[model samples]
Target chain A: MSLSALVLHKNDNVATAVRPLESGDSIDVEVADCAVKIVLLQSIPFGHKFALQDIGWGERIIKYGETIGQATASIKKGEHVHIHNVEGLRGRGDRP
Target chain B: MNFMGYRRRNGSVGTRNHVLVFPTVICASSVADMISRAVPGTVSVTHPHGCGHLGEEKEHIIKTMVGFCSHPNVAGVLLVGLGCELITPELIAGEIAKTGQRFEILSIQAEGGTNATVEKGKTLAAGLLEEAAAAGREPVDISELIIGTNCGGSDTLSGLTANPAVGVAADILVTEGGTVLLTETPEMIGAEDALGRRAADEGIEKRIREITSATEVLAKRVGVDMRGSEPSPGNIEGGLTTLEEKSLGAVLKGGTSTVRQVVGYAEKPTEKGLIIMDGPAHDAVSNTGMIAAGAQVIVFTTGRGTPLGAPIAPVIKVSSNSGIYRRMKENIDINAGDILEGKDSIKTIGERIFREIIEVASGKATRAEVLGHNEFAIHSLGLSV
Candidate 1:
């Protein structure tokens, strides 16, 4: 299967969409020496990230092998991970 | 590796030999511009500051002006002044004289009027240009190269593609004993710890924290949140969700190198390797500061795209995605988007970028230079009044 997205690091929990993905599309991705297949749960815009595995609410969204943010809500495999369900941990006056 | 560069008297190598018409005060900017226009091959450095600044703010402008004039790329300088501003042409000339470069000062008041000053400035600039033209590029080592890295109009691809790819190229440059500058302090908020870990020593790590925190404190004191402005509208639209995410990607351009030192805005680094400049994230302002600090070339990565270039330095623009590269083909120098398409590997593209840097350093005109995009801005720390 052709690679549809890029997994930047082995520890990254999310992958960026190289091309837009629509609901019901089955995608194959090559991550560090391994291949994974997942069915899109919703349409994911190009350049946006999607969950490679189920992420519970408030869990960190890992990319570049680092935590970029935390999921505001539970994110399932292939679900779009963006501002809608993620919260930045930096510079927020509310966060300690 | 060696590239043809103008060897300065002070032992510094310049990628381009240009006679700069530098204005010491905002009041004399028009005459400076006029002189630069009348003399071909001469460039003018004009800004709104140079008067009415207080304390550190005033000193920063002075230092940046001096640095720009003394830059190796400037073969000579024609200093223009209003004669009454805090930063006098004489003072600027004194600073540049330290570098043993040719410089001549013309104050509007001293010359009796704008018309007279313009005439004198034109003749001086032409003479300076003739002297500058006499200089020729000699073989210089890669270690003399100081490369500035910056990103603007960024998107998700910025971190994944262009930024990291530039990072790889930066690593190669550092390995070759060259210097690389990573700026945009506010952009390092979320990734401060990660960057701190890469510092060469505790002092640099502390300075890095100090500068990044200062930016945050200033914004907070002004009753604004840094996050509110970061991960800007363009970033959000391009799939970046938070400031941390944006920052994590933003720092990739520096590569995995030790932070040798953290310098104040427009401050030159004393040590080689990777240095971080303390300045705002504004594209043009940061680029200007780096150029003033003595970066002969800049590698600007963008996802949304910008056409910013420095007057004294060549800014090589790299587009993160193929779409923006195709749309802004005339402006962007290289496309790292192929990495995203699985057509090119990051290391290969990184080598290509490094080679492009060598080419630009050897007098290859970048898109911005060819388009005459002389975007210059100085970061102000205090109110003009």
Candidate 2:
């Protein structure tokens, strides 16, 4: 059985959970026709994103094959990607 | 294809024939409310502007008010003013007169007080409603339609299903020679390359950049990031992390039509096809700008389910999931969730929404209208002085 998740594009490094996914749940997702199986490292709420591979801090996070934001902290594979761990590079009024 | 609509005297097509009661200032809102309540069938709109505004703010308030007052969807307007406000009913009434539509003005100070003015307004509003009631729908070509596309309470599936579905409908409309307006400048943050590439010309491409980049500048000037706000707390809960991600999904409602024109807030478009109106991402005000810009109907997509309706036009909500669709049945009109459930294709859902638009334009009331969701608001560009 496969957990529900969707990867929008081949270049996207994150997959969004179509349903609530728990830690350790294995979801087989096609990252743009390239099938990859990822084990959840953290519980991902419905509509949330998870890393397909380990993402280094400050590395651009790709979704829809474009930069959505950059990782503020290092993200392990299957770790939840959210506001707490990522910062949008655009429209940043806080940065000098 | 043709749909039944009210053809105005100025050669404009109206999806609904409404007798509108408009307040020029917040102070006159109560008077407008009283007048509409007294006149049963009349619709009323009020805003937080009309007095003490300066420069572009004042002009924007007047233009928005005038746009609504002179909208083709409105059969007639009863403009109520507080007499001392900068945005006088006479100014708005004069603008409407140029459109050759029916309108009447009521000044509280000139009529002696709220009681006397409201009594006069009731008479005027009742007359307009009577005239509107007698007006019947005639066949208007589908090409005359200008649709507004927006998304609120969005989520990850929004991009996957409802937004793209709305986009499909937008594409269908554009193909049929109808006009489509896409706005929410704040949401267009990171999707510039995708949107700008679709521009009809070099000037249009520059405008797409100007509007999106301006949103960031405006936010920085206010000393706050667009993160928490543009994604919104609801958006974050629904899994949208950044303004770019949300915008990438948000813009899908515009479909893939060429960008024919880029308009200022509430300004009517001169070109057909997919046009962009510069405005913020807030749903109510964003909807307001499009309605003022001459969209007769709005196809709004939502994953979290927003119950917003325009005072003058119908808002057709497309839900992203069956769960939220079931919970907000009264607020939502169509279910694009079938695509996500593997029951319906995106193209199928889009055709269904396009069909719904024609039906709604033919005088079928939307859920928002049937449920009395007459939500209205004005965009604020600067601090009120």
- TM-score of chain B only, all predictions? 0.97, 0.96
Q: What's the fnat for candidate 1, on a 0 to 1 scale?
A: 0.43
In model 2, the number of clashes is 0
lDDT of 1 at B213: 83
What C-alpha lDDT does candidate 1 achieve relative to the native structure?
A: 0.88
Predicted candidate 2 versus true structure: per-residue lDDT over B1-385, tens digit per residue: 8989999989999999989999998889999999998999899976788899889898888888888889999999998888888889898887879889899889888999989999999899988988888888999889999999889887668887898789989999999999999998877877887788889999999999998778877887889556545666667777888777877777888998899999999999999899999998889999999999999999999988989999999999999888899999999999988876657767899999999999999999999999887888889878577
Docking class of 2: acceptable
Q: What lDDT does the true structure give each of the candidates?
A: 0.88, 0.87
Candidate 2 residue runs with Cα over 4 Å from true position: A1-3, A7-15, A21-45, A49-96, B227-243
DockQ of 1: 0.44
Provide per-model DockQ scores. 0.44, 0.32
Number of colliding residue pairs in each model: 0, 0
RMSD of each: 2.3, 3.6
